[model samples]
Target: MTRDTQGENAPSDLDLTRLLQTLTVESDRYAERFGSRHGLHRTDVNALALILAAARRGEPMSPSALARELGLSPSATTALIDRLEAVGHVERERPSGDRRRVALHVPEAGLEEGRKMFVPLAEAFADSWAGFGPAEREVVARFLDVSTEAMKAVSAEWAPPHESQRRR
Candidate 1:
């Protein structure tokens, strides 16, 4: 019986770990370059990116909703929204139905930046995915979804005992 060379010659788990670390460092460098071009700290850029994406969803934006999406505290989310407002990247409006609630909407400038950052990311992912058929794409998507959920479960289960203290 002949054995497959691919399985026989596969790198060990440690090699995969090193490979992932290298990829993460490269990805961070890319994000840093993009962030520098936009004159934003990485976190600020990420917050603005999320806000613009939510606006594109065609639903009224709620600060609470954004907070939920980002896994951020309400106060932190408010602070982020405030920063965006101060920078003229976003504005708040009181919808007619709810005077007490504020809705976040991105200004044209914010949308433009979001577009600039998202275009390349989207294009790169699409280009890489072009090699996959529908079945393969579906399998990959399902695996990613399951992996994400599993990681979330593990994180939640092992919640740090002093997470709040550590944040300060």
Candidate 2:
């Protein structure tokens, strides 16, 4: 298929690849800075940050939902949740009429403990983007959104169904 070369669709795979790599490195630097404060592994801190952010956003996502959203396998998600729970960052709960379902909630300790480290790191990155003009920022944002959607589609096709469910 011939590619469009004018505007939004003009970027080639090479352009997208380079942008992805740049974003990954920048994000990792932020994550590493944030992780250093917690004495937790990078993945653990990232997972907790995700869960806490979702909780604060009123998403209150289940472990299965988190695994799907984060593109993590069920076992990996469970382990991540376990670590958070152990650290008093989250609580595992089963509300009435939902005996088999587990929901994760952010505890006060998690918020108080992690926010000092995480918030500043996030703000630093946000501040860096503040220099972009509106148009430039919009272009970058759209590219990221589209790229994310493309990965979601591709991952959905390949993710194992058996591993999709919350682990026992």
Candidate 3:
């Protein structure tokens, strides 16, 4: 086998790292295209995804939580939320139980639009994984979970404290 730049064997950890990097770049490119098509910034698209995911998990996000997740300032997050709300893509609801707390939600139209945009990608992922058996899939899932944790840890380590935290 050919040696890599560090004199390591081909198809080693370095190869896997490069593959993951490529996957990230491609995913970002896809998101960029989607943002462009929908008249949104990349950050806006990311916020929408986070809000949608939180809603799906039955734990809706707040502006502050979104700011932390996006590493954005509280003001910037508010601006983003405003833009999304103006576009009818998101809404801020004050739950009846806690009138002071604001919950972010994607309107039904927004959900439908997102579903239309993502269904093709979801199908592609399913098709790609079709050849993998249960054992292989389990290993893949474990790898993904570990990789996600590692990334999150690194992000947390390097990220500066959010502006909201600075005020408190």
Candidate 4:
């Protein structure tokens, strides 16, 4: 296999790829445990995370947007939203002038719940990288940003068109 090598001591592309895969598996395992403890499915946890992130960015997501992000069918997305709503983790609101435009929100309680579940993990991550200097942290951050974009591009290319797309 063709490999991109930086130096004799530096990790090759294959090594980096394998490391990323391992990291993903470990991260998923953590999510699974959190989901179990919270009585949520892994998908539910993922959905909540997306919603929370969007809210933080001042761009609350609609159900359709969440469905696209999750690669879930409309019906399945609705069901997932219903489950979250039942558990008091999500709320649907019509905050726009157009009454039909519904936005997903994580209530204050839900936000606190998420913080309680994840802040320690975030702290642990921060602690792990505490030794890295400014330049090293910049390089690491750039690598992650590029890697995320590349993964998203590949996922978009491989994913089948959602129902909304197909209808257009």
TM-scores for all candidates: the values are 0.66, 0.65, 0.88, 0.88
Q: In terms of TM-score, how similar is model 4 to the real structure?
A: 0.88
- What local lDDT score does residue 106 receive in model 3, on the 0 to 100 scale? 95
What's the CA error at residue 105 for candidate 1, in Å?
A: 2.8
RMSD vs true structure, all candidates? 5.2, 5.0, 3.0, 2.7
lDDT of 4 by residue, 7-113 (tens): 46677788788888899899999889878887899999999989988987989799999997888988999999999999889999998688988899988888788
Off by over 4 Å in 1: 1-29, 52-61, 65-75, 158-168
Global lDDT scores for all candidate models: 0.73, 0.76, 0.87, 0.87
Could you give me the TM-score of model 1 versus the true structure? Answer: 0.66
Clashing residue pairs in candidate 4 (N, C-alpha, C atoms within 3 angstroms) = none
Candidate 3 — what's its lDDT? 0.87
Could you tell me the lDDT of residue 4 within candidate 1? 40
- Candidate 1 per-residue lDDT, tens place, 1-168, comes to 333446876556566456656766887887788778866677666666676667677777788877765667778888888877887777999999879998888878877876787688889989988999999999878956775686678776665545434446
* Stretches of candidate 3 exceeding 4 Å from the true structure: 1-10, 161-168
Question: Distance (Å) between predicted and true CA of 93, model 1?
Answer: 2.3
Q: List, residue by residue over 1-168, the lDDT tens digit for candidate 3.
A: 334677655566666677788999999999898888888999999999899889879997999999878888888999999999988899999989998999999999988888888899999999999999999999989988998898888876776755346646
Worst 10 residues of 3 by lDDT: 159-168
TM-score of 3: 0.88
Minimal lDDT window, size 10, model 2: 1-10
What are the clashing pairs of model 2? none
Q: Write the per-residue lDDT of candidate 2 for residues 1-168, one digit (tens) a residue.
A: 234465555666777687787978988887787667665678777677677778778776689887866667888989888887877777988868979988888788878876776678779879998889999989988978998898778877776766555332
Ranking by TM-score: 3, 4, 1, 2
